[model samples]
Target: MGTMTPAQRRALYESARFARETTYNGPLGPEYTPAGTRLRLWAPTAEQAAVNLYRKGHDSPCIGTLPLQRGPQGVWSIWLPGDQHGHYYTFTVTVDGVARETGDPYARAGGLNGLRSMIVDLARTAPAGWERDVRPVIPPARRSVWEVSVRDFSQDAASGVRPAWRGKFLAFTQTGTTLHGDGIHPTCLNYLKRLGVGYVQLMPIFDFGSVDEAKPLLRQYNWGYDPTNYNFPEGSYSTDPARGEVRVRECKEMIAALHAAGIGVIMDVVYNHMYRYENVLNNTVPDYFFRQNEDGSLSNGSGCGNEFASERPMARKYMIDSLLYWAQEYHIDGFRFDLMGLYDVDTMNAARAALDALPGGRDILMYGEPWQGGGSQLHRYEANKANLAMLNERIGIFCDDTRDAIKGGCFNAREPGYVEGKPGSFWDVGGAVAAWCRSDRLPPHAPSQIVSYVSAHDNFTLWDKLLCVRYERPEFTASDPVALAQNRLAAGICLTSFGLPFLQAGEEFARTKKGVGNSYHSSPALNRLDWARAGQYHALVDYYRGLLALRAAFPRLGTTDRHAPEALQFFSLEQPLVGWALPAAPGDGAWWRALCVFYNPTDTSRVVPLPAGQWKLLSNGTSSSLWRGESRTYERKALLMPYSATVFGAV
Candidate 1:
């Protein structure tokens, strides 16, 4: 049959069910062949679209302007014979009868700051052994995520990374990098390897709009939540942002290096909104790419201006394609969606399904923030966390309940949690901990559905939160003893909890952001990971390492299944104190049969009742020790220190 007429395409584009169609939506950006360079764009509302080709730089005058033919499904296409790679191009489209120019949204590589799309040979972007790069196999429940930003990771002079490699993707590739202090301590990749974290969730590495790629000395800082291009890597993280190939190659090298160290890389993606509403997609297609109100104003659910219309056919296709592109081309192990709730459930599930279809995709991790910053016209049930029941079982959501309960309140830093020694806080903390560890409270179908953590890149660090608590409550001192104990207790609850555990980059070392909760735009001095803290608080690091070791030794703590009749039993649910026992699964190795965890958030000591058996102390508030004939017979009672957590094993 002949191609559909423009009128027919318009009808389909405006139809309510158009987004559900599975037909070929548009071209996958510019494709170069021996015959010619074929360009295709999705601009349904545009009266005309033309390719404005530049010789080399974006500022250079257009060498040629070729008009494209409007094809079926509102797609525009053109083919220029002998138009080879290495040239730059942008689309000049007539939207609402006014001409507007923009870079290709699907460009794999682009000019500095993503001002122009570059025609690149995709094969040249790959690093050596790129095809053989494989993600480490880490079960979701066993996953311990360490969140880091590429720039903040090694931005400080104390980072000990090579001068040139500091704050760059190559920093992860550097071997033997060490932090200088009382004694040399492993930093960067070495530190992560020694910490035994299975995954490193890097802050948005995509081509974000905030940083000026051309100037390395501008001291620009951003968390990369403002996405300008979804497919390409951030140029600022590369040694040379002027060359598109450098960013791509360096990012791949970083991922390969991380994988070599047995650590998977999870890319933090912001598909909820674009850097600007007047971006490429909107300029080329009017309001088709964004959710619109009845008055035609763009939706501000993302709070960054506009919310992407992921339910639309082309928008959904673009998101799914970008995720798969990252997974397949860049070898990204997983994706952490930013403001995932703004997108529709279908889009999230479709992306998950697409990732699972790829090689090693089953092991691919997927998780995101379940809530949006603002209200949208979209149904609340469409949000990821709101609709978690319908989402893919492999997908996970950040547990804000457990996070707030453990780290006081997110908005109010002074609010006390279990670790903060807040009275009656144990009720909420106990509920959240139980929901996290026992699969019954939140009732997740699979263990991977819950990502439990007290602190992340967004909120106040655990140390900072405790400091705020100390200030509000005179009883809670900010001394090293108090901070160290609370930090250890928080880590114990998180690492020993059931769901996939996630920790902020410097959390292990009690890293602080100087009480600045939102340090997204803060100076490097405030944001950079303090390596010295690792030495000053070496005991805290050891406590974290011990917790991870304990979790590794006892696999029952990470069980995905809901608790059985005898699998998990709570000793008491009283305020300021809570205790529970988790029995080892039948097939688990004989390290210990049952593990008992006790929490005493009160200033005074509390007596916790244990099950009828001889138990060995595996860990207490100050330090943790492996079981080596150190047995303590408890006649159904164990004394716990004030504001401390203890782990016991039934031997």
Candidate 2:
């Protein structure tokens, strides 16, 4: 599309007053060229705007200041005649006769601690072989996501990462790294490969405000929820943040390394709110980017002080453009939008449509948290999950029902779920498991629309939750064999469920956050993944590995059709012992034609009668022994151990 004239642009913006389209807002950032750099700022409420060019390593006393000419629809533009690639610049906009200096909201790079926006030649920032980088195509039904934080992945002493590379993006690129195993435990990329997760949903990597990029080793750590620059990579994760290109290159290299290891990368994006109210967008156009209440106060739907008005035309455009930019520029395989429900459904649909239009875009995964932190001005039906019927089939929402059902309530730590042996909890938990596992209950258009998991980055880890429950109830003990069995059962249900399976980092090995529920600002000692824990719970890790392998081997477990009739049949809904049967389809491998899975949370062994066939015991709590001779007659009962799960199959 050609550039629109000033008058045409104004007319376009005016015509689409509240419409959710980005075409009207032309590019609103520094556009670089060999001869010069063209700068544009969208400050509709501003009466004047100017671009101040600064020398390297200097914040004040700019080398030169250029006045920006006013364009239609409150746009200001200025062009330098010579190349300005290495210089830093900031815009000074006079809104309501008050001048305020701010960085470019669309800047691809930022100076120390994001104090200023830097003009960069994006072509030179790409790592070697970046042009050939391609993400692996993973179907939604078969997707296994492993969520991770860049720093926490390798920051612990037992992480086995190199000294210089520890806690940096380069840490993921290390080859043949192993942690806490006697020549058996895989570390880093090899660990991921062995874990069998198809995608790595990385925590926020954008230029966030919490970490001081200028001094990355100053003992400051954040989960990166507070975004400063949407398009730029966070400098704290790079070995050198002084040069903007280094952060960009290191991030791409990390993505390339992950792709090389047969794992796709999913970026966790936070577009609902920024780090501060004094952000660049707010400074340039006061109160324009955020949602306002009837009293002229900013909305706190994000629970982070202010929320972005994504329903607005320009805001919607910015989000869509940022998503496409990352998909193309960084070769991102997918996106995990943080607090996505705060955004309007139309904007999300537009983003999916735009992404689908790109090459190999159909394979890109799109999913997010379906609920927001607080009430939004948009109707409840406009939320992502509430409006799933209107959303495209490719988009998925996290299944909190399954999560809470297996592990207990997220808000209250004392309340126990079915796995915890809570009285009268089996019926609800069984229904939730069937709904998510069979793809028939709580139905979406497709099975890919639901993402099932027991735990994630938000609340307590599975192990920690069990420990907390033990503290609350005298009957439950942390190290009890029954608790361990319950933990295994939770993992079994999550991995064996029908929809996409998601696991938080270190979940396989029983990761813990020391009983701290919200670790967003916790120390590295609390947030870092302790590989030693993996060693302690090696059996549990192996069980998780086996479950993933079994799910991969049996396509019947991961059906993509949501409308397909109940693939699972529960024997009795009222009993504490839950049993289901899954019949395999025709033309299958040596795998059985019919599979029976049973869960017994009671303390005593339960003898449950099977269907009319000789059933082979594939997995029984501890190990997966696929021996054909290890069979039990249908008429003769099968034994289920207390607080354990068993899988039986017959061809």
Candidate 3:
């Protein structure tokens, strides 16, 4: 996904090596501290900038009174050590002799208002980047990962509480959700603990303008996409927004809470660009950061107004440093890079290396959207050991295949004979499932990785997709308002599929965003999960819970190894129902069981061939029931009632 033209590829070695090497010269300085605080802010256009520390009890201290030193290039730095906790600090700079502006240069945490900078208790902070205690431990022989977002987790904040005996570092995982006061709600942590997801992937929490900042039509607040600051979590979501110190402290507290809940934290970072285009950083450091066109225009590589010149060593260093700071300071479990392709391949690898050198390298999860501007294909991303393709062995990606399969468009499943279903219909659902089912079949050059999900923050909810698919083809729509049984079937497909399954905050009860596929501009109603849906569709909710339990119980079902699609044999008759059979391994008599999965997209009885024998029903869509194994001849096939999916095994 690294940016490049075909010409650049031909002479890639030269052009790629030094395409954009400018350093990021914005907000560069040491951490403010108590010997007094020598403060520095990036003010290229300032005649002079001074640090003014305002303490609660002491007299107002100005830069001149301290050891403040104004360096060349307008970087004003000085050692002011008398500062301490409860001290409020800001930089006042005089520009053009008359213009004066005051702001926080290095806010550990706060919103875009940037009225003040918070003091830090570095002693309590987590290591910034990798966890050096562990080396590169090869991934488990099998991995069963479930993705959960924090915001949409149950309202009970304590739901993520883990056993007291298990410490945070030992049991960290990832979950995601809408930003709430003081990070993801406790309910998210509790739900993740109960659900046993390995990680929590949080959406953007940086300072962004209100929807009102843009046009009215785009005025909505379901997502956290509008970003103003790259370094801090938005103060609005913190417990105490009025006090920057409190907000910063609360953020660390939130991370600690999640760790205690036994869930790793993966921040959804928007490093591709920033908000307030005319902010001091971009305007003051001009050519030192952003990419420029040959004609002197801005390069819109990130689909944003401008893309950071990550190719630049300083830009890369800044990003890497920030990442390390978060990993070490906050004990963040992983990072989900936003618009990852905007960064250079080498730079990405370097960041990964830096993380690997950190304290918890073995547990760090690094993954992202391997695309840029919608034009780049996921496969087109850099293939280096650090890229998503290679990282899949270590990290992973938001697998589009799972989305496409349930929609029916995975691999050869689209072509004739490749898949059996209502002919000529877009197998979009099937395609989405294919990512999970057919992933092992991907080219060897591709990483053996998959991030399976029916829906995510960027697209329509799975329910919305089902409705659209039904609308596009009336045959798929339901005659009764029962929310379409096919929708339930699709859910089963995802929970049962291979690889990591990412559940959006609200997909459990078929939450809908009113078909506004990209609900980034929608309000809380569209994004906030209506927990009531659990009562509305108790059947489906229980279904997913059972599925998770089943995955946890059966190691063979969730193997992360490379397995060819042929390992699974698909069978169907008259094509209304499709069945997959996973044969057991040799020598393992208990493992020799065959799971015949049947999916009926129709509203009638489906008689599926089951190698006639008294077979036990491992699980039925309706409830929890275990049927004893019975002997039978391969004569009569099992019968599946309309609009359902059943998994059976030889008794």
Q: Please tell me which predicted candidate would have the highest lDDT against the true structure.
A: 1
Query: Which scores greater on TM-score, model 2 or model 3?
Result: 2
Candidate 1's displacement at residue 247, Å, is 0.4
How many residue pairs clash per model? 0, 0, 84
User: What does candidate 1's lDDT look like per residue over 1-651, in tens digits?
Assistant: 234443454455558766444346445688877568888887766788999888764458888998999887677888878846677889999865678999988888888888888877777777888888888777643578899999988887777888888888999998877776223788888778888888999999999998888777337787889989888888899988877778888999999999999889999999889998778787776677787765567779989888988877788898898898899888888889899888888888889898889978978889899888898967535756557778887778898988877878889877877788766766666565554544344544555567889999997888888888887543321346777778888887877677788999889888888788898887767888878777677777877877787787787666656453235677655676778887888886737788889887667777767788888888877676555445555657778877677888878
Candidate 2 residue 373 Cα shift, in angstroms, is 1.1
Q: How displaced is residue 379 in candidate 1, in Å?
A: 3.1
Q: Regarding lDDT, does 2 or 3 come out ahead?
A: 2
Worst 10 residues of 2 by lDDT: 1-10
lDDT of 3 by residue, 1-651 (tens): 343343332232124343333223445644655565445655544555666555421233443323246665446676656645455555556543543434443456442244445455455343332233222222322233443333333322233324321111211233433223233332344444554555567777555554331122212353556565556665544433455454455556666666555556678887777654654345334344556555445567677677666765555766787787778766777788777767666667777888889766756767666667633212234532235444435555666545664554323222221122345333444433344344333433212255666567776666666655545432321232434466566666766565566677656667776766676655544555554454455566656666665544444454545553346676645654567766554433332266666777666676766765545665665542332233232335777756666766654
Query: Per-residue error at 400 for model 3, in Å?
Result: 2.4
Q: Specify the poorest-scoring 10-residue window by lDDT in model 1.
A: 1-10
The TM-score of predicted model 1 comes to 0.92
lDDT of each: 0.79, 0.78, 0.52
Better of 1 and 2 by lDDT: 1
